[model samples]
Target: LGMRPPTPAHPTPQYKGRARDFLYAGAEAGVMVLNAGADVMRFAPSLVVEEADIHEGMQRFAQAVGKVVA
Candidate 1:
């Protein structure tokens, strides 16, 4: 049984509006996230999610980040 480590908590406090950027980008990429602060994006997933769902979500989220930082 092999499993990857959990994603570390990423709290953005110095970059202004970064969380907001992620929020919009994630939405466009089919991922949902919340801006919990000026630069913090809150992430929450369904309790009854499957492994495949998690992978797909991460892929979409990565796409969103690419859009925001590119």
Candidate 2:
């Protein structure tokens, strides 16, 4: 999340391997993200997911991204 936003013209291309880093870190943090491709990290929390759960997921994801960058 600390990384710059993807460019509108080439979003996924900018974070190709970082997506995998996120997936692994998310898994380690007990978050499941479905991968659409080599560069896509997809999040589809359940329709009944609570707000707190969403916030927690984001925290996990941000931590993962930080580790990856660090």
Candidate 3:
């Protein structure tokens, strides 16, 4: 994946952050996020996925970010 912020792909190495930590936290929160390559987090929801599902997934993602991010 190309440069993506909050996924260890930032232009600044010091602010690149950590994708592993986010992935781990997401897993613990029962949220599944895939890596397109090494940095981009791919969140491909199913066609049957509803609005509420997206909302909930985002909430979980936010929580995971909070866990690993400052």
Point out where model 1 deviates above 4 Å: 1-15
* Winner of 1 and 3 under lDDT: 1
| TM-scores for every candidate against the unseen true structure | 0.73, 0.72, 0.70
Two-way TM-score contest, 2 vs 3, winner: 2
lDDT of 3 at 4: 30
Per-residue lDDT tens digits for candidate 2, residues 1-70, read: 2333322211255566567777887798887876666677777777666869978987987787667666
- Stretches of candidate 3 off by over 4 Å are 1-17
Each model's lDDT comes to 0.71, 0.67, 0.65
lDDT tens readout by residue for model 3, 1-70: 2333332222135424456666677889998876554445667676666769878988998887787766
Task: Give the C-alpha miss distance for residue 10 in model 1, angstroms.
Answer: 3.4
- Rank candidates by TM-score, best first: 1, 2, 3
Better of 1 and 2 by lDDT: 1
User: What RMSD does each model have against the real structure?
Assistant: 4.4, 7.5, 6.7
- Write down the lDDT that model 1 would get: 0.71
Query: Taking the tens digit of each residue's C-alpha lDDT, what string does model 1 give over 1-70?
Result: 2444434335344556577778888898887776766666666776666879878988999888877777
